[model samples]
Target: MPHHDGEQNGRGLSFAKRIYLPRTIGLSVGSVCVAVALYPLPWMHWIWAMLVMHAWVWPHLAYQRARRSSNPYKAELQNMLGDSFAGGIWVALMGFSALPSVAILAMMAMQNIAANGLRLLWQGLLANLLGAVLGFVLFTPQIQLASTPEEIYACLPLLVIYPAFIGWMGYKVALKLSEHKHVLSRLSRTDSLTGLINHGTWKDLLQVEFTRSQTLNRACCVALIDIDHFKTINDRYGHIVGDSVLKALSQALRDNIRASDLAGRYGGDELCVILPNTDLDLAVGILERLRQIVENQVDALLPELRISLSIGVAPYEQHIVDAASWLNEADKALYGAKSTGRNRVVSAPCTRADFQGLALGV
Candidate 1:
């Protein structure tokens, strides 16, 4: 495949490095096979020297060429195609001896397919066929399908080692992909600023907790929290300090809550929590403690600034229709807290008369 020079350079270098060891081992072992097959032939001494150079020297040359190229991946691909071409030439030089020739060509095909899938495999095959035709024309070698014991023995190492190398490479790629997938998944579900679960994910979890409470007849509470006078803080101290306030509040929530509690950033300067297996009184106690912790925070950078939370808690009720109703109750309680006094916690009322009294800020 074609690659742009700038983007592919580092990737190309990695590709070349990955290929280097396998190329060295495969060629070194393959040379033995070719040498054995050529034993009975009356080829010139230069042919023997060329075989030695191809086995011992060519892998290093290919690596150096790819490393120097601007597009290393493309360069490595060309080097691999060259490997196929050289294998074809060796097969022809060995007079088309069946076992060793088939071994070399099959391993080359396997390498190409593993590297870049079908496209590289087909390209390598074409290059190999062309090299075979050229070699046949140059040397006019006699075709010999039968393979001797010496040729088979020489082919053994290549067959055993190269496949294990390919398998290991595949495993490394898979492991790296899985790690990246987890990181991406976490990033998607978390708030970048507060490092808490984001708004949508928290809402999804609220529904899940609500369903569990309904099915298991368990106690749970939902809390909606907002920073008191957050807009004033942002205007007075700027967004940077405001962000610090939010982070500090989140830290307070994280530190004070049980491990089972789920906290999230609901929106700008607003947060939420799900307290599973907790009644209204316990939820109030937990959030009130969180509020005191945030209110007591002392920042060396912004000493004059103080932070407080307005929180509303709604306990799960059998009469609550769905997760949305429960969240709405918590939201109403939060509104009451902010409306009456900005730095207090308000619990949702059970009766309609109490709800009306809360709505009127009585």
Candidate 2:
């Protein structure tokens, strides 16, 4: 019988607030139905007074009681059970007249199930039964199954409006849950530091893109980017500054690339991008712009830092066997960029012979 987060210990105010308005509405409408049904009977004057207090005063008193309690969630649960007990007592007082009694029990059951599912529902039912039995034994209430037309009319608001309101509440909860699930899904696939697609997710997308490119005979390129002298930068000016450098590069890629381009943090001090519907020249241009942006903007943003990028880009070649070989070509070009000069973009053009040579480790 797990409850919602707001129902957890020390979250009393939230739990209390959630139940208060609904209780107020249900009890208020319910009071009308009970008063109408019992109007012709010669019940004690105090019974009428008790009905007035229960209808008008109880909702507010219950809210304050739960709000002030050590555990508002638990207190609210108790309050709901108390509501069920009182509902049963109302049924007995009305001589078990059909419409009002059914309205009270149905609303109670709905709330109970909504609060904590089947577990709380059964508890509420038992509480209702106990209250009815006690009322019958003490008061010797007359059993009148028939309801007057006026009494049926009085129960109508509770029957119609209350359930509709409860349905609306359930709908709101469902929407919140959907939003939470979407957030979680994105978080799982994203790099927390860079806010880009993570390595594994990006790799998965690369495979899918590879298949699509082969099927559609469309152009696509993959770029492997490394932060030039990243280790030296970290050694000179702590990890915090190093982190800023990575974020700067990531931001530059986001700002410069097309909407369809996918950028990801591949690993330490290295990032990758998947440029769909792009050729070698277009990919190089995109990376060059990103490189210039990082070089120019980073110093202004973080005065203590001056950053540069080394990028390797490889376009999809018909001869390339798989995504791994294509990525390897980009990796090789990236290595060439790093070996020759720090801030440069290198393109690896793979031919059938190059692919065969790579496969043969020649």
Candidate 3:
């Protein structure tokens, strides 16, 4: 089973820093080399050229960083920056192929642009085309002055093949980087034994759901479930069997829940379900069916197995205003059901204030 760490947009900054720092340093050194080689060019020309290229890039970098940090305008900023960065890289690469003395400077500009928008394939293609054209133009003087037709023909392959080779390498590198990031992300959020969202992930998701529900006035429900006699199962059949039971139960919960609902392993023998756009009654009905399914399976396998669940359901907004309070209410109700004897669903208890002056007048 795959392990996942909790979801955090910029959580792997340290790892990202480690990977990018060397590349950044390498690019920086290469840029310095380009500046030295282009020393024969006027200083003002060099500075202005660099500035023009960077002007198109810095905003894209800022936008990318902001998007990774979960800025609200991420999608729009991403699209805008993606296009700008790709165009910039293409132009810079073309300039480098045309002017070898300033190749380092052009490489630097291309690197910066590529770092932010390499995910955009169309942009990369445009950059490669620009580079190929610049390469042809820069080498044309030599081709034109060639003593033999063969000499001119010999340069044809380089013009046709080099840019394509470079673009392919760039694409491969991007794919590898994406795969690594994906592995790291999965490692951050998944529980190993149960194959469900871990406790930390659950909390993070709950907060997001709560905020969305509050802002959109959408209904949501939280259900807390505890496996009855879980400790006894572990004691009687060994921890391995107990773990298997937990994994099976987790799959059952996930299969039973709606696509929008999130099920998580909260702690030992305690699982949680978050039902977006669901009322308390709907949540209860779902859990009740889940309980029946689990009960039937357990009975069939271990005929004497007395496994059951105690569930607590609470509606968002109507029951509690915030995630913490909502979870607390469901937990309290779960405890109530457990105390009464398991295998039952209970609604969260309303505060005395909520009962409001209406006494039983018998």
Candidate 4:
């Protein structure tokens, strides 16, 4: 069967620095405690060396291997498995002493779950079992089921502090991932150029707005607004100045519209708005005011640069069968406005009976 080790390539550096390092340190410290629990045995000196190597040296070696590997994620996962094996070896060295053995197993299980849930836990457990068998062949564990009070005390600090520390670390990781997810979601929906909603997100919202309008028999309006002579602006003043003009327009739209209104950049130079439960006349009045505000703002801010708007307003009619038809009607009005005068607002003349070709897109 295939396994889902914690080899998520996207988690690369953060996973190592935040999670793996701390786990290594915990395992190392806990190993020493288990080693000390086996105190003054004939093999205790060798066990001390092993503890130092596993605790002090192994973490750095694992980090280096993970960092240098072509697939860092996969390498880190392998390192975790190695950690389990090391843990098993220590458990046997302690003669399977109750306090320290249970501590090692619990801590290892916690680390596995934190890394990638249950699958990795099982894999780590298997590694532990195999390593235990190896340790039995090599050293022949004394199988001390009950621990002396001294051994129990030695195991206490690691058991208490390590879990608390790891728990705090887990909490921090959760918060960071949550924040990252929110940022990614916003980036996906927003236009980079203008801070308005992007084309695809706006279209998705339009469908929802269309459904609300249709099912409730509500009056809803869509306005398609285009920047007049944008090409001329770019030609005369260059793209940077053109960008300033778009930013200015975007700001104006943001300031003028209500929070309930949906404003988005449809494509280059063309911005659209969805006005729910509003009539054509009301929308026109609103757009006309917006037109004046935008023109005056641009004039006040950048007097040398002159720019204007052409806006089209179309009410969502009961006869309009689909989202495409609603958008088309508004688009037609925008074209009409552009044709009549560069700076004006026009309404779609009438709903069309010829909805065959376009209706399929609904």
Q: On residues 149-223, what C-alpha lDDT tens digit does candidate 2 reach at each position?
A: 999889888999999999998898799889999999999999999999999999999999999999999999999
Give Cα-based local distance difference scores for all models.
0.90, 0.88, 0.63, 0.83
- After superposition, the stretches of candidate 4 with alpha carbons farther than 4 Å from their true spots are 1-11, 28-36, 39-79, 116-123, 126-130, 147-174, 298-302, 348-362
Better of 1 and 3 by lDDT: 1
Higher-TM-score candidate among 2 and 3?
Answer: 2
lDDT of 1 by residue, 136-162 (tens): 999999888899998888888878887
Count clashing pairs, candidate 2. 0
User: Which ten contiguous residues of candidate 2 have the minimum total lDDT?
Assistant: 350-359
- Please provide, for model 4 over 33-146, each residue's C-alpha lDDT reduced to its tens digit, 9 standing for 90 to 100: 776677745675667777788888888888887877766777888888999998888788778888888888889888888887899899999999988889988999777778
- Candidate 3, 146-169: lDDT as tens digits: 123332343344333433444665
Error of 1 at 80 (Å): 1.3
Candidates 1 and 4: which is better by lDDT? 1
TM-score of each: 0.91, 0.91, 0.57, 0.75
Pick by lDDT: 2 or 3, better one: 2
Give the number of the best model, judged by lDDT.
Answer: 1
Indicate the worst ten consecutive residues by lDDT in candidate 3: 139-148
lDDT of 3 at 53: 48
